[model samples]
Target: MTASTKPYLLRALYEWCLDNNQTPHIVVWVNEHTRVPAQYVRDNEIVLNIGQTASHNLSIDDEWVHFSARFSGVAHDIWIPVGHVISIFGRESGEGMGFEVEPYQPENTDTQADKPQAAADKPAEAAKPKKGLKLVK
Candidate 1:
């Protein structure tokens, strides 16, 4: 089995943003398992700036991207599964790559994983936007 290219692309894009003197931002899909500042999420998605000035201890790995940052004077620990990342781009020009969002599957869960109909019904619900933060395209 080969490693997924998503993580590698994420790292490369982040570095490209830095090298170009642009702020790097990531758009993520928030779900029950995603650990993020809820107040900052809207439409089940959030755009985050991961520039050097915005985050600390930033790490982008095969499974997860973790970092610490302050929001409204309060520090927050952001943990996002790579599967939930929609895109990574520059805040200046919005130039970056978008990744396909893979359906989150728990390793040992037995909840509708085998049911295609149940899975098909989820998209409508997922399309509904929650109110709060604004999504950047």
Candidate 2:
């Protein structure tokens, strides 16, 4: 199997934004695999400022984009699956790329290799957002 090009493109665009002195932001599709401030999500999505000034310990890897940032004066650690990123664009120029949201699919594992014991023991449904909110068209 071949690796997806999405992560590479994301990194490239992020670097481009920084080179041009623009703030980079990402549109994230909130899902079970995403760990963000749920209270700030709108329409099941959140826009995150990923620029150096806004985020700390930022990492954009093949599978995840991890960072910590202040939201409403409180620090929050953000964990976003690369597949859930809808788009990344410059806040000033709005130049970047968008990708189709990919559904989270847990890899099948026997004995759950490499996964933390606690995480492996937790039920998948436990990570899901609570129901009650609905998007009105």
Candidate 3:
């Protein structure tokens, strides 16, 4: 499969927000791999302002977004996997883009046999068939 377009769109939106004199902010879904300040996280999600003055050494790459920012006078090294980023927008106007969360599938997992087939695992009744058949002539 081809690469995901999320990272490119994120970069573009960030640049657009800056160019429009708006502060860029990002919404991230917190996971075990996400490196962020726990105290600042609420409801398993965190909103971070990524304006030049708010963050240092910020880099938004294809795989992750890395940066350092101070929270309550404590500087933290934040690293968010690109897939966990829910959205990026202008903090001032709340105008930006939201992305669908893509589940991360590990390449080196040992539980292949233990895992059940995704389609087979779902109950067939979960999807109700059409109530009536179509007419054919």
My TM-score estimates for the predictions, one after another, are: 0.77, 0.81, 0.76
Which ranking of candidates, highest TM-score first?
Answer: 2, 1, 3
Clashing pairs in 3: none
Model 2, range 1-137, lDDT digits (tens) per residue? 99999989999999999999999999999976678888989999999999998999888877778888999999887878788999999999998899999865556433444343433433444333345533222
Predicted candidate 3 versus true structure: per-residue lDDT over 1-137, tens digit per residue? 99889989999998999999999999999866467888889998999999999999888777678888999999887877788899999988999999997654434323333322431222333111122433222
Q: How far is candidate 2 from the true structure (C-alpha RMSD, Å)?
A: 6.8
Order candidates by lDDT, high to low. Answer: 2, 1, 3
- Candidate scoring better on lDDT of 2 and 3: 2
**Candidate lDDT (C-alpha), each:** 0.78, 0.80, 0.75
Using TM-score as the yardstick, the better of models 1 and 3 is: 1
- Give the poorly placed runs of model 1, Cα more than 4 Å off: 109-137
lDDT tens digits, residues 54-125, model 1?
Answer: 999898877778888999999877777788999999999989999999755555324334423322233332
Least well predicted 10-residue stretch by lDDT in candidate 1: 119-128
Q: Kindly report which residue pairs in candidate 1 clash with one another.
A: none
Off by over 4 Å in 2: 108-137
lDDT of 1 at 30: 89
The best candidate by TM-score is 2
